[model samples]
Target: MDTSTWIGIFSVSASAMCMGIGSIAPALSEGKALQQALSSIAQQPDEAGTISRTLFIGLAMIESIAIYCLVVAIVLIFANPFWNHVIAKPGG
Candidate 1:
């Protein structure tokens, strides 16, 4: 109803949506990557070392995306720029 209340609602909704989508993507990616890595290792047991090393690096990179999304969601929910603006308005 009020400007501040609206901003708070919007911020929370945005953060929840961001975190939900962000987490899903990375979860799917990690699952697929793990499946592929296992397949590769199965096909070439001798190259397990190299394949495993590469897999770990790739996993870390994929995980970073989720981490970034989490941070963004947290910022949006707890430290939203829009919140400051709305709260600062007269009679907010």
Candidate 2:
């Protein structure tokens, strides 16, 4: 009913949505990337080392997206900037 309550609800819901949607895309991308890398490696066995190294780096980069989402979710839940704004509002 209050601003703080609304902010809390919004923050939690947003964080949940952030994590849920964020994880799915990265997961799907990782899977697809892995599939492609594996197929490439299979086709060029002699280039396996280079392909594998690049695959790991690519996977790590892709995984950073999910990590960023997780960080955002955590910030929303635990350190919400909106919470300060809501709290500092004039006699809300």
Candidate 3:
């Protein structure tokens, strides 16, 4: 009901949403990438090493986005910027 309480609720909800969507997208992307990489390696056995190496690097880069989202969600939940504003307000 109060401003601080509302802020906390919204922060937690936003964080949860961010984490859920963020993790799911990256997981799906990683799975698809892996599948494609495997298919490529199978088709070109001679270039398996190169394909596999490139796959890993690309996967790492993609995974970084999810990690960043997780970090942002954690910060939102645990150290939200609006928390200070709401708490500092009178009768919050």
Cα TM-score per model = 0.86, 0.85, 0.84
Clashing pairs in 3: none
Q: Clashes in model 2: which pairs?
A: none
Q: Judging by TM-score, tell me the better candidate of 2 and 3.
A: 2
Which residue pairs collide in model 1, if any?
A: none
- Give the per-residue lDDT digits (tens) of candidate 3, residues 1-92: 77788888889998999988889988999999999999998899999999989999999999998999899998997778899777777877
lDDT score, residue 67, model 2? 100
**Candidates sorted by lDDT, descending order?**
2, 1, 3
**Backbone collisions counted per model:** 0, 0, 0
Candidate 1 lDDT over 1-92, as tens digits, reads 88788888888998899889889989999999999999999999999999999999999999999999999999998788889887878888
Error of 1 at 27 (Å): 1.3
lDDT of 2 by residue, 1-92 (tens): 97799988999999999999999999999999999999998899999999999999999999999999999999998888999788788885
The best candidate by lDDT is: 2
Better of 1 and 2 by lDDT: 2
Deviating ranges (above 4 Å) for candidate 3:
88-92
**Per-model RMSD to reference:** 1.5, 2.0, 1.8
